[model samples]
Target chain A: AQTVTQSQPEMSVQEAETVTLSCTYDTSESDYYLFWYKQPPSRQMILVIRQEAYKQQNATENRFSVNFQKAAKSFSLKISDSQLGDAAMYFCAYTPGGSQGNLIFGKGTKLSVKP
Target chain B: NAGVTQTPKFRILKIGQSMTLQCTQDMNHNYMYWYRQDPGMGLKLIYYSVGAGITDKGEVPNGYNVSRSTTEDFPLRLELAAPSQTSVYFCASSYRGSNTGELFFGEGSRLTVL
Candidate 1:
């Protein structure tokens, strides 16, 4: 069984600053995928970024990026130039290749942005 | 387009009651999933379907049932409601060979068992 862990239960960042949320996973499969999802107060889950284990280069989408370290099974999400709209509960998820698209999610990190 | 839609955004049921949560998608995705999000916890997979007439269990499927009659709809049924079953349920779908493997989610259905 694969499990995802988000160590930080809560994180805070200033409006113009940056913040990093830590995530780690345990899986035996060599081929897998990682994702970061954001849930605002409106309760809508939005995709932030994703990373493929085979890719050495990390994934970046606008202000959201991931530091994917396959060897250590660590995948962290970095938010650059944070905005107030970024306040929400962020979840880290994992899915192995060739599966039925089932995702394993971590407890989540509640990120709050200060203006 | 309405990617995914879940009906009865909010519902409250008495103990031992039964209800079904309706989910529909417009993306023509072959795979659909049901997940429950407990307070302060991540979403847990309840059930999934690969395509029409095919369904499977996920991490947590107890007290729940699901059916996939068409590629566009997947409905979750709670046979007997319990307080422990109170949570926000989410319906999601995605293409089998999607490039990003991203799951498009519905707004969610909150159910409370009292």
Candidate 2:
């Protein structure tokens, strides 16, 4: 069994600024996958980025990127040049490599962007 | 493309009431899953199916039941509704092959048990 933790329950950032959301997980498995999903007011869960445990390099998707520290078991998301649309609930998820793809998610962090 | 569709968008139930939350996907995905989201809790898997006629319990399945009759549909049922069961339900699907593949989620169905 694995669990993800999002320490921050809420966050805010100014328009065109940068903000980072922290995430940590507990897993004994060697091979796994980590993901970040964003849920806006519309309640649609959108995948922001993903990182494979085998890869040492972090993942980046445009304005969204991740700082994955494998040994420390930390995967943080950084949103740059933040926009109002970026204000939403961001979740961190974890899943083992060989399972049925059941994702264990963190409580989530509500991000607010001020213009 | 009607990726994953779940309905009704919102529902209110009383104790002892029974209802099924419908889910359907047109992407021909082989894997479908049911997840419930509480206020501050992210999503907890209730049930998932690898393929038609094959389903398994997930993290939170005590008060929920699911059936995967067709590859396109996986419906979740709540029996003897309890206030503890009130939450937003989301239906998701993914393709076969990679276990690390991405999941496509529906807009979600909000249910309130009184």
Model 1 CA deviation exceeding 4 Å by range = B97-99
**lDDT of candidate 2 at residue B107, scale 0 to 100:** 100
Each prediction's Cα lDDT score? 0.92, 0.93
The per-residue C-alpha lDDT of model 1 at residue B43 equals 95
* Top-scoring candidate (DockQ): 2
Question: Per-residue CA lDDT of candidate 1, range B6-114, in tens?
Answer: 9999999999999999999999999899999999899999999989999999989999999999999999999999999999999999886323657889999999999
Tell me the deviation in Å of residue A13 in model 1.
0.4
TM-score of each: 0.97, 0.97
True contacts kept of each: 0.44, 0.57
